[model samples]
Structures are given as C-alpha cells and as structure tokens.
Target chain A: SQTIHQWPATLVQPVGSPLSLECTVEGTSNPNLYWYRQAAGRGLQLLFYSVGIGQISSEVPQNLSASRPQDRQFILSSKKLLLSDSGFYLCAWSPTGGEQYFGPGTRLTVT
Target chain B: AQTVTQSQPEMSVQEAETVTLSCTYDTSESDYYLFWYKQPPSRQMILVIRQEAYKQQNATENRFSVNFQKAAKSFSLKISDSQLGDAAMYFCAYTERSQGNLIFGKGTKLSVKP
Candidate 1:
C-alpha cells in the first residue's frame, strides 16, 4: 500500500518569514503529486502539481511555489510569507486516472 | 477548463436515514472521472467513492453510492442509514483523462443527528 507523508503537521510562522513544507510518497514511484491549500471555511485550492521530477505546474499564482526534487518528494516553499499564506496545506498523490490519496496535511499559521 | 460544483453549502440528516448530496460538473472531455471525498473533523481527506464517466452504472461502496448522470452532468452521493461518523465536509472532485490534477468543489458540510 502506498502512503503520503507530510512534515511539520502544524506550523507557526511570523509574517515576512520564509516557509518550507515537505511531502513525500512511499511505496510508489513516478506518482503524480499535488499541493492544495484550504483556507479557513474555504474550499480546496490547487496550488501546484507535478507529473514528474522537475515538471511543476502552478495552478494559481500566489506567494507559494512547489518543486519536485525527486520522483516522490515534493516541497512547497516561499521566500517571504504573507498573512494570506496561512491555511491548511494538503499533499496528494495519484496514479494514472486512479483515486487520489491525501496526506495528513500541515496547518500553517502565519501571524 | 473543467469545473466541479456543489451547490448545497450544508446539509443535515437524521441517523439511520438517507441523505443525498448533490454535485454537478462541466467538462468537454469524453473520458474523465468523478469522485466524492470526505474531510472529517480530523481534517484527513478520504475517498468515499469514485465513478468513471464512461461507466453508466453508479458506483457503490457499502453504505455509500452515487447517482451518476452523464448527460445531466450530475453526480449525487447517497448515504444510507447515516451515522454520526458520517458527519464531515463532502467535496465533489473531477479529474480529466489527460491531466492528473483533480479539481474540487467548495464542499458541502454534512451533519448527522441522533
């Protein structure tokens, strides 16, 4: 069985500070990875997705960026964080046309 | 661009009763997929059920089932004998045949009462 893991289940960052969230998949190779952000009481917003290593697609333009450094490792980063950047970040993975599996998610609070 | 819509923002159901959550989507692709995901209070997104657009018959998983109408572009979820554990924010999602990215609706919060 494949599983997705995300680091820093909860994070608190100061405004204007940098941000980094990591997600990796185990038991699967060359899987599609995605980063989604959900604001308080809002829906899931696709931030970025990667089909393969070094192939990243940004769904919405914002203060965040995503990178696929490895086949199953995806990282979300920001040079400077904004108050609006606070939200619950979820990492998901899926095979070709298969069901998507979500990670536990990281609750980021930018104060 | 494909879009998923869940018009009902919230819904309630009495325990042991049936409740249906509505979802509709717009797409031009002939081959695609639709899914219902449950985000419980724990905040973990779990796939409740999935249906392929090509398949005419609805998909069922235990107490959960879908009424997938391809022509109507409607895919509604029916939870039979709902339980307290069924309370969660249900989201309708769509994935194109070519793209692995799944588009999600705003979600409908389902509250189950005793």
Candidate 2:
C-alpha cells in the first residue's frame, strides 16, 4: 500500500519568516507529487506538481516554491511568509493519473 | 482550460436520509475524468468516487454513487442513507485524460444531522 507523510501538523510562523514543509511517500517510486493549499472553508488550489525529480510545474503564481529532491521526497518552501500564505497545505501523490492519495495536511498560521 | 463548479456552498441532511450534491464542469476535451474528494475535520483528502468521461454507465461504490452525464457535463454524488460520518467538505475535481493534476472547484460543506 502507498502512503504519504507530511510533517509539522500545525505551525505558527511570524511574518517574513522562512517556511519548509516536507512530504514523503512510501511503497511507490517515480509517482507524481502535488502541493495544494485550501483556505478556510474553501476548495483546494493546486500550487505545484512534479512528475519527476527537478521537474516542478506550478499551477498558480504564488510566493511559494516546490522541489523534488528524491524519488519520493518533495518539499514546499518559502523564503518569506505572508499573512495570505496561512492556510491548510496538502501533499498528494498519484500513480498513472488514476486517483490521488493525500497526506495529513499541515495547518500553517502566519501572523 | 478546464474548470469545475460546485454551486452549493453548504448543505444539510438528516441521518439515514439520502442527499445529492451537484457538480458541473467545462472542458473542451472529450476524454477526461471527474472525481469527488472528501475532507473531514482531520483535513485528509479522501477520494470519494470517480467517473471516466468515456464511460456511459454511472459509477457506484457501496453507499456512494455518481450520476454522470457526460453530455450535460454534470456529475453529482448521491449518498444513500447518509451517515453522521459522511459530513464533510466535498470537492469536485476534473482532470484531462492523461494529465496528472486535478482542477478543483470551491467545495460544498455537507452537514449530517441526527
């Protein structure tokens, strides 16, 4: 079975602080990885996706960036956080575009 | 560009009753896929159901089923005997036939009352 793991279930960060959220998948290799953000009571917006290592495709222009350092390791980062960056960040993986499997999201609160 | 629209922002249903959530999408491609995802208080994105646009038959799983009308671009979820555990935010998403990413709609929050 494939599973995704994300760290820092919840975080409180001050404005202009650096941020890093990591996601790792188990039992799969070369799978597609995606980063999404959901505002309070809103739908998820795709921020970035990677089909392979060092191949990140961004859907929406934002202050954040993504990197695939390994076959199953993906990281979402920001040099300086903004108040608008506060939201529920999700990490998902897919195999051959069938369906997406998500991890327990990171609830980021930027003050 | 593909876009998904979930018109209902909030919905409520009594326990053990049935409820249907509406979702519509726009896409120029003929072959694609539609999906519904559920997010509980835990904030885990759960795959509810999926329908391939090329398939004519509706897709069903246990108590959850999708009414897929490819011509109308309508895909709705019908939850039979809705349970309290079914309460959550439901999002409708669309993806191209070979695309690895999904385009999601503003979700609809479903509340199940006893």
Q: By DockQ, who's the top model here?
A: 2
- lDDT per model vs. reference: 0.94, 0.93
Interface RMSD against the true structure, candidate 1: 1.2
* TM-scores for every predicted model: 0.98, 0.97
Top model number, lDDT: 1
lDDT of 1 by residue, A1-111 (tens): 898999999999999999999999999899989999999887898899899999999989999899998999999999999999999999999988467999999999999
Q: Put down candidate 1 lDDT per residue, B1-114, tens digits, no spaces.
A: 789999999999999999999999999888999999999998989999999989989999999999999999999999999999999999999987778678899999999999
Q: Candidate 1 vs. truth: CA RMSD?
A: 0.9
Model 2 gets an lDDT of: 0.93
Question: Cα RMSD (Å) between model 2 and the true structure?
Answer: 0.9
Clash pairs (backbone) in predicted model 2 = none
Model 1 residue pairs with clashes? none
